[model samples]
Target: MATSEKQVMVVGFDDHEHSAYALEWTLKHFFAPFTSNPPFKLVIVHAKPSPPSVAIPEASEILRYTEADLKKIAARVAESVEEICRNKLENEAIVEVMQGDPRNVLCDAVEKHQASVLVVGCHGYGAIKRAVIGSVSDYCAHHAHCSIMIVKKPKTKH
Candidate 1:
């Protein structure tokens, strides 16, 4: 990581927990060198749920977001990301709001942006839950071209 070359893409979701922390961690840990110098870039991705997954609740079908609603939602997601990185990221992170599966959108961004690293947070699912749903963190770890870091939330003892 030199002053002239630094490009990191951080993916975020509606939830502001471990993934957000991981995004910050990516900047502080992985891309520290560039932050200390110059020529650094960070891209934050906020993705909307896809069609089948984002469908209306069970019952008589009622239309959810039309074209306009979708636009508004995307804009809001981008805005939220922008706000988070406004003064926090020293490298001037770029925020993007996309609509689709989180993993797919992130993978596409990684390729399109030529990202050096991809960072995301894990939900910390139990063994059975993970086996059932298939964790995004697991998917990225396997699919990402570059290095992947999955930030795990610190467990609190009851």
Candidate 2:
């Protein structure tokens, strides 16, 4: 039996600091083929909120925003990733944004894209808060089908 080729998809939001760090992380860590090799796809996911005017709608309603806006946000996030990649890996990378839960959506993308690795960032809420609210990274780490990388942001100096 032969090993299948590997692909990577990184998931996160462009608005959050931790997500930005996560993007930086994927660029630094998830190295696929560079020269004459299968390209790795970077996925930056943002959950657009449902508009308030309309009555509560189905899950699909959550992603009602324009694709242009979504792609622009994803591009900005990817630019950060690209900067990190150029400095560290000496290469540019491909990036995309898909809407949904950061965990479920990412895992789904991994399955759809047949990605071997999934990288995401963990934003640490206090233990009490996390116990009640749950964290996206924690969920992904436990449930994702692919090899998962959970990036953590460093503590800020007071």
Candidate 3:
């Protein structure tokens, strides 16, 4: 079978539409071609940011938020991503939710999984905002260990 030489591919996911669209496009464009060539395994990764260091004066409130809570949420999000791709994907997909900087986390996952490609959606960041906040897509494009595909949403007519 073409699937004998299976390779791993990673897609950066969020609960948002752009992320969903990226997954759809990947399945349609990239994965569909897998049947003829070597089959590829898909992994959707979400890098959940850790809680912020806000100045909440109440120690009790801070105590209420635990690592377990964050991990639970991350697991739920991972499941959702898996659900999105379940129907169309040829094989079962792996959903991983990690905590850290998104760019670094995704890159690490690619390296760890030995993925052939990393797919992400462009958030339409303008020059100034991207300059200020440093776009994750931009960072991963340059930094990811594997090949990267940045899917941009087409502008809709007003």
Candidate 4:
């Protein structure tokens, strides 16, 4: 079948433990018994922060260095995601590194990929923290065109 014919599942990955857990959980629950033909096409998205616009000469130089560092981070993130998928289902996935706020990037990816579902890991932030920093999952739940699944890592036994 053509790629577009299959339902797409966009997974938000940020090189964080929570995101990794979400990917693992999704694979275990939905793609278990690893068939040659899974139900949905997996697409992992990593959103990199956009460089700030600074007018000062020194700031511009700093921004250039930061841009390079961001690229390195993106590469590492892609590699980690690939390793995770390889170890789990041995399945192939498209990994994209986008520049923008995660909430916007993820929602845009869903629209671009025509995804049927979007899976994101929750940071388990308190109300104040979530309000201040903002929650990507919460934003996506409201803005994304597809169904949103916010996976929260279970608390470890003390």
Instruction: Name the best candidate (by lDDT).
Output: 4
For each candidate, the alpha-carbon lDDT, in order, equals 0.70, 0.63, 0.82, 0.91
Q: Which is superior by TM-score, 1 or 3?
A: 3
Model 4, 37-109: lDDT tens per residue?
A: 7788899999998888898887988999989998899999989988988888756888899999999999999
lDDT of 1: 0.70
Candidate 1 local lDDT, 46-150, one digit each (tens):
777654444446522433445456667778767766666664566566777777888888888888888877778888899899889887777778887888877
lDDT score of residue 103 within candidate 3: 90
Q: What order do you get sorting by lDDT, best first? A: 4, 3, 1, 2
For residues 1-158, what per-residue lDDT tens digits would candidate 3 score against the true structure? 24466778899987677888888888888766674452577888999877666566775476457666777778777877777667676656788888898899999999999888899988888999999999989999898888999998778999
Error of 2 at 114 (Å): 1.6
> Candidate 3: where are CA atoms >4 Å away?
1-4, 33-38, 53-57, 66-73
Off by over 4 Å in 1: 1-4, 30-40, 53-61, 64-73
User: Per TM-score, what order, best first?
Assistant: 4, 3, 1, 2
Q: How does model 2 score by TM-score? A: 0.64
* Top candidate when judged by TM-score against the true structure: 4
Instruction: Give lDDT: candidate 2, residue 119.
Output: 70
Error of 3 at 134 (Å): 1.4
| CA-only RMSD, every prediction | 4.3, 5.2, 3.4, 1.9
> Backbone clashes per model, in order?
0, 0, 0, 0
Shift of residue 155 alpha carbon in model 4, Å: 0.5
